[model samples]
Every structure is written in C-alpha cells, then in structure tokens.
Target: MKAVVNERYGPPDILDIREIATPEPKAGEILIKVHATTVGRTDACALRAHPFFVRPYTGLLRPKRTVLGLDFAGTVKAVGTDVMKFAQGDRVFGLTPGGYGAHAEYVCLPADGTVSAMPSGKRFHEVVVCEGAWYADTYLKKFNLESGHRILIYGASGAIGTSALQLSKIYGAEVTAVVSTSHLDLARRLGADRVVDYTDEDFTKISESFDFVLDAVGKTSFFRCRPLLKPEGVFAATDLGPWWQNVILAIWSSLTGTGRVVFPTPRSNRSFIEFLSARIELGEFRAVIDRKYPLRDIADAYRYVETEQKAGIVVIEVVPEDVC
Candidate 1:
C-alpha cells in the first residue's frame, strides 16, 4: 500500500508519498481499504505540532506514527478473529487512534472504536469525513438547547461550526451564525436564523444577549465575549484545558459568575456517529466539502487547509495507483 508518511513534524512539505506495507487487523481490529478521509484543523495542528503541548502526545521531536489522518470512510476488507459485528464488504466510517492512518490505501482500526455504518443516501466520502462534525454535534447536545433560546456560533463556516449551527437549530435553538462575508450564504443555508458578517461588524457590539455562545474556531477568548452572554448563558471554545484551568474555572464560576466559560473536548463514540447518521438520513444535516485531493496531493491539501480560508472539510481520496 502507498501512504503519505510524515517522518518529522514541520510544514506540509515534510509529508512524503511513499510505498509502505499494508496494515493488518489485530485481534480486536478491522482492516479497511481506505477510499476517503479528511484533513482537518486538528490534523494540521498535529503536523505543525502547534501550541507546543500536543507535541508530547504526537512526538517531542518527531511524530511517533508516521502516517497521519484521523477520520476515515472505507470498505471492510478483513476483520480480526475477535470482530463479529462487520463483514468483509461492509461500508463504514469512523475515527481512529493516533490519528489513524487513513491517508493510505489501507488502514486498521479497533472493531468497536468510533466505527459505524455509513448513513443512507450519503456518499462514502461525505459520511467518512463527517466524524469531526459528529463529534461537535455530541458536544452541543450537552447544552440541551431549547426553542426561543438565542445561540451564537462563531466561525460558522468551518466543519465544526457548520455542524454546530445545524445541530443547534435541530435542537430548537434560535441560531445566530458569525462568519466572514463570503461565507454568510453558506451559514444561512445551514439553518442559522441570523448571520453576522464578522469581517464588517463586531458581534459583541450588537445589543443582544445569547443563551449560548460557541466559538468553534477557538480564536476568541472568554473575556472578550463575556459581556455578550445572558446571565445564565455559557461560552464554549475548543481550547484544550490544563487540569488547573478546569478546576479554577469551576471554582470561580461557582463563586461570582453569572455567565460561565467552558472548554469542550471532542470525543468519538458509536452512538454519536449513529446520531449524526440518523440526522443525515433525515436530511437535517449535510456535509460541507471544500475540496478533494488524490492521495499523492496530500501535502497540497494540507496547504489549502492551513490557509484558514477553506469553508469546510478538505478530503483526500485514496485509490490504487501504480505511481511511486
């Protein structure tokens, strides 16, 4: 099998296309012939080893796992002896450990790890690349949004933001999406009740309070948006928290806060995948794709995503090709 291997962490240029041995399923794993996968912000972050903290898990000096990719959509070519839920021909999509090796023609994953049947009426590429969206949807569910509740989604045009907007509406919140001028139409189509062009206006200056304010891009800090929240409203961002930060925030919020700050860490699970699948089948959610690249063009795909201008998910399609 041919895979894109990153020997060290740096720019997208460090990733190289090379012929590698195909992976086999372990006792509790399944071997998939990867047809499609996605390049997300997280993947780019891992590549550049940004924020410095992630380096310990990814690698201090170089990546521990040479192959990089997190989400996958592919057909089961084989299953380990311990696996009984799927057969050789089943189509599935899910997340993998160590940002599983989905950037290749073949990858292996645990049988019970974030794997699920692809949603009906959706393409493999679309379903497989939606793991990030599904994860975001799960987090939004924790808020239990209700009708008439005003909610704001910042970075509403990215994969997680787009999913958050649609899921918030489905959960009955009156959605307000904050996006760049070019992506206003895209956010509106995803069911935002009101769209704010962040490039032209500052949303915090508007005279309105929201029950929930989600910064999907992690670009905004809690202090900057605290004034925009209602007394009981919640402000959420994707910034990973240190243990101390979590504890301190919890204590401080209990002491003197009307509004609270939250850092949501996305988790992958089968139920969340199933929930997202049901929504997709019901036509309540749709995958937003920015572009698709062949496996050899993985580096180029990373470049496109790093620009921060991509409106949604960027995918890599892995197929059997004779090129070295």
Candidate 2:
C-alpha cells in the first residue's frame, strides 16, 4: 500500500507518499481499497494541527496517526470476522473521523463507524464530500430550519458552505449566500435564492436582515453580522473564530437572548451517511470538485486547498495501479 504519511505538524510538504503496510481489518472492522478520497480543509487542518486543539489527541509535538485524509469513497476488499453487514466488493464511502487515514490506497475502519454503502449514479468526486456535508447538515439541524425562513451563509463555496446552502434550500429557507465574485454563480447554481459578491459589496453594511447567519468557513464573526440577523436570530459557524471568539459569542447570546450564537457539536454516524447516500441517489445533493490530483501529487493538493480558492471539494483519485 502507498500513503501520504504525516510525521510532523507543519506545511503540506510534511506529507509524502511512501510504501507502507496495508491496514488489515480488525474484528468488527472492514478493510477498504480506497478508489477516491478528498484533500480539503479537514485534511489540511489535521495535517497542520491548527487551532492548537488537535494537538492534545493527535500528538503534542507530532501526529500519532501518520496518514492524513478524511472523506473517502472506496470498495471493500475484506471484512473482519465479526463484520457481517458488509462483504468484499461492496462499494462504501464515509468519514474516518476517529483516525485520519483516508489519504492512501487502503484504509481500515469499524463497520459501524460513519461508513455506509455508496450511492449509485454519482461519481467518486461527488460522493467523497459526504462526510463534510454530514457535519454541515448537523450544524443547521440545530436551528430546526423551516420554510420561509430567511438565512444568510457566508463563505458559500467551500464544502460546508456548499452543503449548508443546498440543505437550507431543501428545507425551504430563502437562502442568501455570500461569496467572492468568482463563486457568485456557483452559489446561485447550488440553489441560493440570492447571491452577494463580498468582493464588490460589504455584506455587513447592507440593511437586509435574515433569520439566521451561518459562517460556514468561520470567516466572519457575530459582531460583523449582527445587523443582518433578526433579533432572535442565531449566528452559527463551522469553524471556531480566532481565540475562541465564537465560543464567547455563544455565551453572550445565551445571556442576552438577543442574537444567539450556535456551535453545534458535529455528529457523524453510519445512519447519517446512509440518509445522505439516499439523497445523492435522488439527485437532491452534489459536491462541486475544483480539482483532481493523483496520489503522488497529494502535497500539491494540500497546498491548493490551503489557498482557500477552491470552489468546493478537492478530490484525490486513488487508482489501485498508481497506489499499489
């Protein structure tokens, strides 16, 4: 097997593809020969161990798990003795949130972990964004979004933003997405009722109000968007603001009962993935991939994602020939 091993927490160059032992399934686990994976903010964050929180569990000075990747779509090559639900040749796609090891030819995960059968019709690049979408879905659900609700989503081009935009539309919310000029059309294509080019206009300066404001990329704060939120509206984010500012905002909102700030705890399970898979099959959701890279160019993929210019997911196509 070949994998991009990460031994330290630093630049994307810290990861390099090398021959490594293929993982074997433990009891209740499945060994998947990954055909496609994604290198995005999740992989980038875990690789660099930013925000200083990933250090405790991953490793203080270095990473405990050398392999780095998150969302994966692959085929099951083998299953552990206790895993009866899946068999060899079954197509699967899900998140390895427990351990970052999806950037490789093969990965082993517990059958019951955020794993599910891959939905048909969609390409690997599209399905590979499911994990991030799952997280985005979870955060929005906390607000119990309903039809006719007016909402604003900032950074509406990344995985979480894209997912949030589509899901919000499905729930009947009138979504106004804020993105750069380059991504204005992308947001509209994803079903945003309205799109704002942040490059040309300052969204915060506008007089329009929304029932909720979600900073999908954690690029803005409550203070900047407070005017946009209805009095009882909520301001939530996928990424925590600098120095725990979002956390402080959440607490402040709780006490004031004015503009509430929400930070939903992400929950990913097999059941969630199963539900999302069904949606993908129905053409209700899709992932916009900006680029594709072979396993050998994984470092470059990471660099590209770090640029924050990607419109959606950055897929890493892992054919067995190139990996093995």
Candidate 3:
C-alpha cells in the first residue's frame, strides 16, 4: 500500500509518499481499503507542529503517527475476529481523530470507533467530505444553536467555517460570515446571512451583536471578539491560539460560571458520522470542495491547504471513486 508518510514535523515538503506494508485488522478492528480522504488546516497544523504544545501528543522529537490524514471514506476489505458490529465489504466513511493514517490506501480503525456505514447512494469522494465537518457539527451541537440565534463566524470560507455557516442556517441562526475578499461570494453561497471582508474592515468594529461568536481559525481570541457578542452569548474556537490563552480563558469561564467561553471536544464516532450523513443524504448539507488532487500529489494538496485560502475541503482521491 502506498501512503503519504510524515517523516518529520516541518514544511509540507517533508511529507513523502512511499510503498508501505498494508496494515491488518487487530482484534475488534476493521481494515479498510481507503478510497478517499481530505486535507485541511488540521492536517497542516499537525504537520507543522504549530502552537508547539501539540508536540507532546504528535511527537516529542518526530511524528509518532507517520501517515498524515484524518478524514477517510473507503470499503472494508477485512474485519478482525472479535468485530461483530461491522462485516467485510461494508462501505464506510469515518474519522481517525488523532490516529492520523488516512492518507494511506489502507487503514485499520477500531470496529467500534468512528467507523459507520456510508450513507446510501453517496459517492466515496463526496461522502468523505463529511469527515471534515465533524468538528463544526460537534461545536454546533454543543452550542445548541436554534432559531433567532445569531452567530458571527470568522474565517467562514475554510473547512470548519463552511460547515459552521451551513449548520447555523440549518438551525435557523442569522449568520454573519467574515472572510477574505475572494471568499465573500462563497460565504454567501454557504448560507451566511451577511458577509464581511476581513482585510477591508475589522469584524469587531461592527455595531451588530451576535448570540454567539465562533473564531473558526483561532486567529482571534475571546477578548478580541467578546464585544461583538451579546451580553450572555458564547465564544468558541477550533484552535488553541497564542500561548493556550483560549484554553486558559475557557477554564476560567467554566470555573467562574459568569462567562461564555467554551471549547468543545466531542468524540467522533459512527453515530456522529451517521448524523452528518443523514444531513447530506437529505440535501441539507454538502461539502464545499476547493480542489481535488490525486494520491500522488498529496504534498501539493497540503501545500494548498497551508496557504490558508481554501474555500472548503481539499480532497485527495486515493481510489478514483466518483462521489456525489
């Protein structure tokens, strides 16, 4: 099996595709012939070892998990003896969380982990995009967004941002999406009620207040965006920006019970993927793909995602499967 191996933590150039031995399923695991996967900011961050704190988890010196990918959709070629929840030949779409081996043509995940049946009638490539939406869906669920709520999503054109914008609309929230000038239309198309160009205007300078503020890119802190939030509104981030300040603030808010800073960490699983798949199957959700690259060009895909301009998910086609 050929896989993109992260030999060390540095530039995308350090990643290499090599003919590695295929993995076999352990007890209570399933071996998948991965057909499709995605490259996003998470992959880039893990690769670059940004924020520095991740080093202990990813690697102290070098990457512990050499293969770099999180989202994958593929067919089950084999299952371990103790696995009863899934069988061979079941098509699935799932996430690795921090396992980080989805870039390969084959991967082994616990049978009861994030693995789930792929939504019927969806293509491999298209269904794989749902894996990128896991975090957004998790956060929205935590916030319990509902009708009449308003959310200001900064960096609304990226993977998590795109998913957050659409989910906000699905929950009937009035969404204000902030993005670069090039992504204004894309933000609107994703169901943002309004769009702001970050380069031209400061999002925090606006008069409008939101029921919640989500800094999807982690570029800004709760202190920076708090003024834009309603008196009791929530502020959240996907990334732990700048010296773990957000993490610190989130802790303080939890302790004081007087603030609304939250960083949600929902476990990804079969049920979670099924929820996202149900939305896609109903045409209520769709993956906003920015570009597609062949398995051989995965480094380039990482290069593109690292540029920080992608409007949605950047996919890597591993098995040439058509997706919807």
Candidate 4:
C-alpha cells in the first residue's frame, strides 16, 4: 500500500508518498481498500499540527499518525473475527477519526466504529465525506438546534461551513449563509434561506438576529458576531479563534453559566455516519467537491486546503473510481 507519510509537523512539502505494508484487520475490525478520501481542514491541521493545542492528540513534537486522512470511501477487502456486519467486497464509506490512515490504498478500522455501508447507488467519491459533516453536526447538536430557529453560518463555502448550512436546513432552521462573492450562489443552492455576500457588505451589520451564529471556518470570533446573536443566543466556533480566544471564552462561559460561547470537540461514531449515509441516499445532502488529486499528489492537495480558499472538499483518489 502506498501512503502519504509525514513524520514531522510542518508544511505540505514535508509530506511524501511511500510504499508501506497494508494493514490487516484485527478482531472486530474491517480492512478496507481505500478508493477515495479527502484532504480538508482537519487533515491540514493534523499535518502541520498547528495551533499548539492539537499536539496532545496528534503528537507533542511530531505526528503520531503518519497518514493524515479523516474521511474514506472504499470497499471491504476483508473482515476480521466477529465482524458479522460487513463482508468482503461490500462498499463502505466512513471516517477514521480514531487513527487516520485513509490517505493510502488500504485502511483498517474497528467494524463498529465510524464505519458504515455506502449509501445505495452511491459512488466512493460521492460519499467521501465525514470529517466535515461530523464537525458541523457536532456543533449543531451542542447548540441543540431546533426547527423554526434562525441561524447564520459564517465562512459558508468551506467543507464544514457547507455541511453546517445543509444540516441546519435539515433540522428546519432558517439558515443565513455568509460567504464571499465566489460562493454566494453555491450557498443559496445549498438551501440557505438567505445569502450574505461579505465582500459587498458586512454580514454582522445585517438587521436580522439569529438563535445561533457559527464560525465554521474558524476565521471569525464571537465578539465580532455578537451583535447578530439574540439574547440567550449561542455562538459556536470551529476554531480556537485568534489567540485561542474561543477556547478561553468557552471555558469562561462554562464556569460562569452564561452558555454564550461553545467550542465543540467532535466525537466520531457510527450513528452520525449512518445518519449522513441515509441523507445521501435520500438526496438530502451532497458533498461539495472543489478538486480531485491522485494519491501521489496529496501534498499538493494539502497545500490547496491550507490556502483556506477551497470551495468545499478536496478529494484524493487513492484508487481510481473506474477501478472501484
């Protein structure tokens, strides 16, 4: 199996594709021959180990997991003992949040983990989405988002942002998507009740208030969008914010019982994967693909994702779709 190997924490240039031994599944695990994967903000953050806080999970001085891919879509090559849910040749797509290795031709994950069967009639590339939706759903779940509630999604063009927008709609929330000019139409097409072009005007200055305000791309802060939030409204950020203020504010909110700022730490599980798979089958949610790269050119993919300009997911073809 060929995998993207990054032994150190640095730029995308540090990543190299190397031939590595394919993993065999352990009991209660499944071995997947990865056909497609993605390089998104999570992969970029893990690759560089940025923000100085991801160190504890990735590694203190270096990356513990050499292959950085969070989302994977592939076919089950083999199943280990007691894994009755999946069989060889079953198409599967899910996440590898526990120990990411999906940037390769093969990955092994617990059978009962975030792994799930591919939605009926869906291709590997089409369903190669989990990390972004998982994070977005986590934040929404933390906010306890409900129908008829109004919400604003900042940075609505990125992977997490796009997912948040679509999921918010599914929860019956009236969504306002904030993005630059290039993504204005895309946001509206994804079911945003209203689209705000941040370049043309300030979204924070808009007249409407929201039950929730989400910084999906981590580029904004609670203070910057506080006025948009109604009283008792919640502000959630995907990033720690500039100078780690989101985390600090989250702690303060928890201690003070204000419930103002929330920095959700996403937990990967099969339930959400199952939910997303069903949505895909129902044509209720769709991945927003920006670019596709072969496995060998993953370093370039990393560079693109790091730019923070990608419209949505940057896919990696570990195994070509034709082959799959």
Select the stronger candidate by TM-score from 1 and 3: 3
TM-score of each: 0.91, 0.94, 0.92, 0.97
Q: List, residue by residue over 170-283, the lDDT tens digit for candidate 2.
A: 788999999999898899899998899999999998878988899988889988998998877888987778889888877786788654888778766678788889888988
**Please, what are the lDDT tens digits per residue for candidate 4 over residues 160-262?**
9999999999999999999999999999999999999999998889999999999988888899899999999999998877778999999999999999999
- As a whole number from 0 to 100, the lDDT of residue 9 in candidate 1 is 85
Q: For model 1, what is the alpha-carbon lDDT of residue 127?
A: 72
How many residue-pair clashes does candidate 2 contain?
0
| Clash count of each predicted structure | 0, 0, 0, 0
Question: Which has the greatest TM-score?
Answer: 4
Worst-scoring 10-residue span by lDDT in model 3 = 125-134
lDDT of 2 at 268: 63
Q: On lDDT, who's better, 1 or 2?
A: 2
Better of 3 and 4 by TM-score: 4
Query: Where does candidate 2 stray beyond 4 Å?
Result: 255-259, 320-324
Please name the candidate that would achieve the greatest lDDT relative to the true structure: 4
Please give, for residues 98-207, the per-residue lDDT of candidate 1 as tens digits: 57588888889888888888887667777754655765675576556777789888899888888888888878889889999999999989888999999899988878
Residue 300 in candidate 2, Cα distance off native in Å? 0.2
Clashes of 4: 0
